[model samples]
Target: MIHRLFRHIDAGTTSYTDETGANPVSSYTCADRLDRERRTLFRDTPLLVGFSGRVAKAGDYVVEEIDGRSILITRDREGAVHAFHNVCSHRAAPVAQGSGNARRFVCPYHAWTYGLDGTLQSIPDGRSFDGVCKSAHGLSEIPSAEKHGLIFIRPGGGDPIDVDRHLAGLERDMAAYGFDRFHHYRSLTIERQMNWKLCPETFMEGYHLQYLHRESVGPIFFSNLMAFDSFGPHTRLTLPRRRIMELRDRPEEDWRLIPETAIIYNFFPNVTMVVQAGHVEMWRSYPSGDATDRCKVQVSVFTPEAVETEKARKYYEKNIDLAIRTVDGEDFPLSEAIQSGHAARAHETLIYGRNEPALTHFHASLNGALGA
Candidate 1:
C-alpha cells in the first residue's frame, strides 16, 4: 500500500506521464535544462544566495557565483545592499577577488575603477576616448534584496519580484525558528559529482536514514516522516524524534521541547534548508556543467549565548564539522554514483518511495517549470 502511494506521488503531472501508462521521471539529462537554468533561472530570476549577517557593515562584501556568473555582493555607503556582475566594464576583467571589505572595485586589466554603487568612477586617460561615456560604461547592476536576514540576487537584468512576496510561507517558518535573531558563524562548501537535484532529493526524505546514516544520525531521528504543505514550489518536511528521552513521550502539545525536531525546506530548483534542534544549515546546488553539479552547503550554528561563551562557540563548531564531514564523506558519494547510473540509461525512470514525498514534489515542480 505504501509503495502504491509512492507511485501515485511520483507519477507527477500529465505532461510527464509516459505512453506506457507508467510514471515518467523528468529528464534532467538534457543540456537544455542546464542551459535554461543558467540563462533564465540563475541569471534572470531572483535566487536566494546567503544570509545578511555576513555583510552587515557598509564596506563588507562577499564574492559568490550564481548560475556560473561571478557576483560581487556589497553594501553601499548608505548601507543598502547591492549586487554587481563581478566582470569589469573595461576588458571584461574580474573586478574583485574573494570577498572582503572594499571601498571600491578596480579592474586590473585596464585600471578601470567602479564605486560600490556600481558607478564607473575612473578610466585610464579619460581624454583619449572622446565619445566614451562613464555613465553608460558602469558595471552591470544585478538586482538584490534582503529579507528575513537572507540575501537574494536576480541575475537576469530586470526589475525583481518582492522578496517578501516570493518567500510568503517561508517567512513564517523562519520566524518561528527565530531566524531573524540567528547569527552566522561559518560556511563550508562541498563539491559533489552528481546532478544538482540529487543533493536536495537525498536530504528531503528520512527513509534513507535507517540504512545510510544508521550508525551516526539514525539514532536521533525517526524514519517515519510527515510533510508540511508545499509553499509555492518549495516543500517542508517534519522529522519526528526517535530515542531522545526529552522528546520521546511528550504529547503533541509539548512539541516545544524541540519545536518540530527537524524541518527540511526545499526552495525550488536547487536550494534547501535543514533546521535542526540547535542550528540551521542551508544547501545551494549549482550545476557545474552539463554533467556535474557543485553544491555549497553552509552550516549556520545559532544560539543567543553563542557569542557570550567560548565553549558554546567551540561546541557548535564541532557539531557543524561532524555534520558536514558525515554528509560529504558518506551521503554525497552515494548520490554521485546514483546520478551517473541514471544518466547511463536514457529511458529508465527513477522511483520515489512512499515516505519520499518531498522528492515527488520536486520532480513534479521541475516538469512544470520545463513544460515537459
Candidate 2:
C-alpha cells in the first residue's frame, strides 16, 4: 500500500474507477429512504462498535445508541464478549446507560437485574407477577463478535457475526497495526446538520482538502490524490502527506507508512477507521431520530499505548483538537450547506467524478444494499 501511494505521488495521478457515478438527491432527503437504510445497512450489518481496549477486562462494557437502537456490549467473567438490547426484560426500559465494569445491570426503571451474560439474574419482588417465567425473560441477545482487536455488533439479530468473513481480505493489511493493543484515549458524540452519509464522504475523497481545509490541513497533503481499493463493500484509502516525498531519498525497505500517510478504512455503511501518524480515529455515523437531514456521529481516538501521564494525555488531546478544527469546523459546516441544498431540491442528483472512486464505490454499495 505504501508503494502504491509512492507511485501515485511520483506520477501525480490517483486511483480511478471505470466511470463516474450519480446518487439521487432524494437518497439524503427522503424519510422513506432513511428507514430502508436503517433496516438493511445498520440493523442487519455487523458494525464496528468499539475496540478491544475499551472493554479489555472482565465485566467491562459499553453502551452505544446506533440509529436509535440502544445496544449494550459486555465482557463476561469468563472472558467472553456479549451484546444485547439495553432494554430490560421487564417493562422494556434500558438496563444500562454508559460504559463501565459491572457484574450485573440493574434497570433504572424497575430495578430488574441482569447478569453480564444477559441472563435475568434477579427481580425485585419476583413473586408479584403471576405466570411470569424468569427463565424466558433474559435480556434480548443480539449478534456480536470481537476480532482483530475490534468489537462488532449487529443491531437487529439474525445470524452470528462473522468478522473474518465480513472483512474479506482486508484483515491481511490490518494485522500489522495490532489494533487489539491500542489503548482508548478519548471519545465524543456530536450531532451535525447533514445527512449521515455525508460524514464519511468527507474522509473518502481528497478533492476538497486543498480548497476547503486550505488553512488548516490542506498544506500538509497533496490535493485530489488518493490510493484506493475496495474489499467487498469496504474500502481502504491511503492519502499521502506532503512529507511522503521525503521517502525518495530513503531506502525502499525503510519506507515506513505510519508517519507519512493517513490510512482510512471504511467499514461499509456507517463506520470509518482512520489511521493517522500516531493515533487512530474511529467514526460511526447514524441518522438522528429518523430525520434524513440530521445525523449524529460517535468519535473515538485510540493510541498505540496507554496514556499514563499528563504529558501523554496532552499530546493525544492535541491531535483530537486538530481533527475537530479540520472536520467539525470546516468540512461539516459545508456539509450542512450541502444538506440544505439537497432539501431545497437545487439538483436532482449528486455526481461523483471518476477520480473519486471511493465515493462512487460507497454510494454504489449503499444502493445495492438498499436494493435500489
Which candidate wins on lDDT? 2
Model 1, span 292-314: residue lDDT tens = 44444433444433355787777
Q: What is the TM-score of each candidate against the true structure?
A: 0.85, 0.97
lDDT of 1 at 322: 67
Which window of 10 residues has the lowest lDDT sum in candidate 2? 168-177
- How badly does each model clash, as a count of residue pairs? 3, 0
Go through the candidates in order and give each one's C-alpha lDDT. 0.69, 0.88
Per-residue CA lDDT of model 2 for 203-284, tens digit only, reads 8998888899889989998888988899999998888899988888988899888788888889988888889977999988
